[model samples]
Target: MSIEIFDGIFRYGAMTLLLLICVFLLRSHRSIWPGRLGASAALCTAAYLGCTVAEQDWVILLLLPACIANSVFVWMFGLSLLKERFRPGWPHWGLMVLILTTGLWRKFFADADQMIPVVLEWAHQFIIMGMALHLLWVAWSGRANDLIEARRRFRLYFIAFTPVTMIAIAVIDLWLTPDVAPYFLMALQSFSIWVFAMVILLQAVQLVPEVLFFPAVVLEKNLPNVVSAVDQIAARDLATLNAWIEARDGFFETGLTIRNLGDTIGIPEHRLRRLINSEIGFRNFNDFLNHHRIEEAQKRLLDPTLARLPILTIAMDLGYGSIGPFNRAFLERAGQTPSRFRLQMPPGSS
Candidate 1:
């Protein structure tokens, strides 16, 4: 088959599949961000396909807008990882405007300047790749903090999809020569989109009970055996878990260490560490203690009877040697200092 014929077939086929995925996203009741992004991506893909099939010089102008759409798709995924409802702020708008301006200048003003277009395209691809990688890192690192099952699953899907798509595109753009058949690149792009679409479909299927009764079963299949083994340990150590929970309030002891606590509780320090880290989902010993201390502090801070008590007094009472550590921990968890939190609380709150 001729390269042009293959490219046409692949592009059209990909566009059709992308359109269906866009429609499915739009129909879903879930967050609209993904749908909007998918739609924009689909539109850009269609435009690029049109340009390729038509063999028109004017189609080169479409590259800039397509790049912007792709960037927005990546930006939206990043925002989804950080917040439930993300409105594009000044930085995002400024970056998009700057990219669009540069692309326009290259297409219109850089007459016969092959170097400028090449440079701009290279810069654009690198920026997109960097942003996608950063978002994937954020998703991977923040997964433990995400308590909502659906949102966590969505983040996982994005984490899995973004790096592969970005790396593949980077390789194709950097290494592929003009002499190479366009269908090869088209096929690679289509396959990546197909995989992403499949991920979304699987996520949607999780919403339907008949299609898959237990979504976690599928997720567990993908996870390492270490996680399940840890879960088993967490389940089996019920006595230690209960003892730790009952004695968690003692965590406020000044200069308390895991070894000292383990000695007092008659559990091995290493086992206690595992129980706290694996069972309780805390990554650090300090964080585990901080969580309990901060909870108690919050109660006292908002207590109507204790409203007149000084913040430092409460901090010291919570086993914190000084107010500074307590204040920082409270602020980290509550997004405000103890005094501010007390002031904001409704009067007469118990």
Candidate 2:
């Protein structure tokens, strides 16, 4: 078979697999975001492959829409970082409309200047890169830490890395000469489609019912042993856990670190980290500390007797080195600034 025909077969085969996975995820997953994002990614991959095979100016038309769809998908993922459900603000929609209109004008009616298309391509690349980086930062900084373990793992492993790889591939495509384009296309197609397929499959497995096809009696029989093992492990740490709780007020010690806390509780640092993350439901160490500190600060802020106390003084007493961090954490947890919260408190609240 000719090399061109072989490439076509491989590209189409990958695209077909991706499409099937997207469909399966759409059917099985509860959230529509994953399905929609997967569909957009598949379509974007197909469009790029089509443009590569045809090598025609008209293919730019297909490529432009694909880019637009992928941009929306990236925006959706970015939103997922901030909240469980998000409605895209006007700025997002406005940017989409602007990109589409500019693309059409450049493709159909603009002057024969090559610079315009180059500029447009770079603009789209910048936007994609920004969204990708934002998603990665959210993952790396533990903004998604509150997610269940399965979803958290998925976000970190697949969602965080995909865009970095995509952006690298795009950069390679932009800079490489035509002589190397075909090889790059082949590699990009094979790697991206397979990676996506594997990620979706893993996610599907995670979403499966825990008991699967097992009979209830068998599951019940196995459940006790599993529960017993977990309980035993937890029980072993009971003393350390109790010590940590008894010293909870010590969380307000300035410059306190997890290592210090672990030492105080007589548990190793790694073990302490695991305990807090898995059992206590805290993803970030600072978040765990802030939980207690913020609660104490809120009580002080609302107390009429302490109403005369300055916010800065309250922040310092809570182990925050500065008022800025204290205010931000308070606003995040309480949905208002300390001052605003205090104003809304009942006049004689104790």
Candidate 3:
């Protein structure tokens, strides 16, 4: 009885908190993708929790659509955090539609066939596990090279372990629950949901990072103050580092790493990381190199002498081993493939 009472209290409290979080995010940062996606996730969670408490079937009926989309919103939110120019393409929307369709089918037509429900249940679980694994992959990728301190921390905490917890809850609800589960077990599940809600509420309220809402474009507006922004490095030392990197002794190395670059330049790796993040306006080491490589590629593409040069040769000359990485980096930075970019530019224009 006591557990049930506490469970009800926590669940209700969490729902209220999630609503507040959604409201705050909508009011404060709705113009940004991360804020909007975070609010969507919060609302979905609140609706999901509400379904458990609602006595009326009509209430569940209305809230069910929103509730079933929790994972999709989470995955989108993580992507927004990763890249600044994230757009919800067909794949993202398609997955959402599939999740919604399956959910509504399972809820409305669940009893039509035993086999159908079983298949739907397994499909739903698979989708969830896939999303969880993707989020984990997204969080872990480029973590060491991530220069944004707050975002790195956010990935480590909210984006990393939270998905694992969600996966565990999903497994328990799907297959592990007995035919006649104990009341305490039920209470435990409710409490876990409440705790998940609480964690998101904290993050929404600026617990993890206020910069979580900052646009990636803002990071490129100005160069960092060498002495002020980077405490360990001085102005002259920075000039030397800049000169060395700009001269292409190491940036063009085929298999360059931050540690290797730092060792060559006689700077500590962490300080080098800070310098790139602050002074260079890049969040990743590879991004910094890609910026130089792509710039060189553009110049070469526009040169009359290189007009007949194969794109692969240009990519190889620019220190990229093959065309694939070069094309991907070029497309990401220039918004077009290398061939298209070359064709767009007049010969010898740049």
Clashes of each: 0, 0, 0
lDDT of each: 0.61, 0.61, 0.76
TM-score of each: 0.56, 0.66, 0.86
lDDT per residue as tens, model 3, 1-350: 59779878877887888788889889998998888998898899889777756778899888988878887887787777776456778999999999999888987888965888778877987898888888788778757667677767777785645678668757865775334556576667667767766776676667766346666532332243233434445555577677775687866778677788878988888777767776666776777778778877898888877778888998888789888999989998889998888887764553
Task: Rate residue 124 of model 2 by lDDT.
Answer: 58
Q: Candidate 1: which stretches are off by over 4 Å?
A: 1-6, 30-32, 48-67, 78-89, 111-118, 143-161, 174-183, 205-350
Q: What tens digits encode model 2's per-residue C-alpha lDDT throughout 1-350?
A: 66566666667776676667656656664255545555555566666555555566667665757645555555554454333333456876777677666656665776766688777767756766776676676666553333234444555674556667657755764566345766646655555656665655555455532211111111121221221125665645645565555466576888887778768767777666666655555555676667767877888988888878899999999899998989988986788999899897786664
For every candidate structure, what is the RMSD over all alpha carbons to the true structure, in angstroms? Answer: 9.0, 7.3, 3.2
Output the worst ten-in-a-row residue range by lDDT, candidate 3: 217-226
- Rank list by TM-score: 3, 2, 1
Query: lDDT (0-100) at residue 35 of candidate 3?
Result: 86
How far does residue 278 in candidate 1 sit from its true spot (Å)?
A: 18
Instruction: Give the clash count for model 2.
Output: 0
Report the lDDT tens digits of candidate 1 across residue range 142-250: 6654434455566677777766677666566555633474666766675565566555455544553221112111112112122224455555554555655556656
Give the Cα RMSD of candidate 3. 3.2
After the best TM-score superposition of candidate 1, give how far the Cα of residue 36 lies from its true spot, in angstroms: 3.6
Per-residue lDDT, model 3, residue 110, is 83
